[model samples]
Target: MATTAQPVAAREAVFVARALCKTYRMGEVDVAALRDVNLMLHEREFVVLLGPSGSGKSTLLNILGGLDVATSGALHYRDHDLVAADDAALTLYRRQHVGFVFQFYNLLPSLTAYENVALIAEIAHDPMPPAEALARVGLEARSGHFPSQMSGGEQQRVAIARAIAKRPDVLLCDEPTGALDAATGVRVLDVLETVNRELGTTTLVITHNADIARMAHRSLHMADGRIARELVNSERVPALALSW
Candidate 1:
């Protein structure tokens, strides 16, 4: 339960994927979700993965989050080999190192925003106070409200708060703003940007919206289960500067 911030060294990669593959078996046929993918995410970097539907973005995110195991090849997070990790080790890694946010706001309907965030913090080995985490997402005033009482954007902010409350080393977001309208999505993205900048957490956001690439430190384009291109922004724009 060490809360001290560790300086991210320059030597080793945080994530290392080499010829990773994942296939799903549906009855008599096999559906290949990911094919020979190799990628790395460094510490404190904001990376956006852009891809159309059925392009294996979610599959890659799942594999990185330890929610699903790769079928072949090597997947390593720091010194730990993720592809060979057992269930217990995976659970430990997720609990200690990773945070996840999804498209839908999965907050419990009965719990207030503060309580919902506190639930996760209570279980985390080293967590920030729920109030401080909620404030980071611009939800300090709405802390007592339930998900039903909040707008879509506000609910999403609460979800972000919950994800970051653990002060995780890595944050994995899959279509975090998919359910919100343009204006609201921008606001949600603002909070995400703030989290990335202030906390120095290594963030990977997967979205189909091409405009989002403007805000990332590096943008990754995925096609047919492989990375098609990678671009580093010379001067990354803030989320508020993004146009549809």
Candidate 2:
């Protein structure tokens, strides 16, 4: 019964999408991945998108993160027009403002944790020290360890550290816990929660897990190709207390 109401003043909007659409071309036909979707993401808000497979959750997240473009619609990240941005502009936007975490921990096998994270920091305009980023994820001791030497959850934490070292304005995660066991997933989720709360990074997560929604400030349920419902959590459930 909680509405999208808060006692505090309204936060500034970071992303605004109006009448968004994305269509995929098959060998012989066109498939609509998204249909006239509308949404707004506020600064420092933790938002979750939930849906079954093929419901367009990933498509929407990809579009927002600049991994893909919408077929048509008004999509803006602050003052930048996402829908109108060229490949170079979109790439720049992602590098300068967005951090991405995927289901798989895409850590380079040859690199140590610190080195993997330093790869991003080296190119970032203003980045946190790789050691500091590792410490933020509770992996300071594992900084010299390679991916193969770490557990799945640890590797994922390293991935998260690499993403955030750039101090991005927004963090987008796609099924970040999908490949891990329940306990490991919880640990990863806690790291994400800590990052969002401590750094005030505007965060968005895509997941099929309903329990994860309880941790979000707001949840968007998707069906077919659009948002079916939106809920504002009256109270957030801590990541440690969430069950599958």
In terms of lDDT, the poorest run of 10 residues in model 1 is 1-10
Q: After superposition, how far is residue 201 of candidate 1 from its true place, in Å?
A: 0.6
Clashes of each: 0, 0
lDDT of each: 0.90, 0.93
lDDT of 1 by residue, 191-236 (tens): 8889988998889999999899888877889888888888877667
What lDDT is reached at residue 121 by model 1? 98
* Residue-level lDDT for 161 in candidate 1: 97
Clashing pairs in 2: none
Question: In model 1, which regions exceed 4 Å deviation?
Answer: 1-12
After aligning candidate 2 to the native by TM-score, how far in Å is the CA of 102 from where it should be? Answer: 0.3
Candidate 1 global TM-score: 0.94
Q: What TM-score number comes out for model 2?
A: 0.96
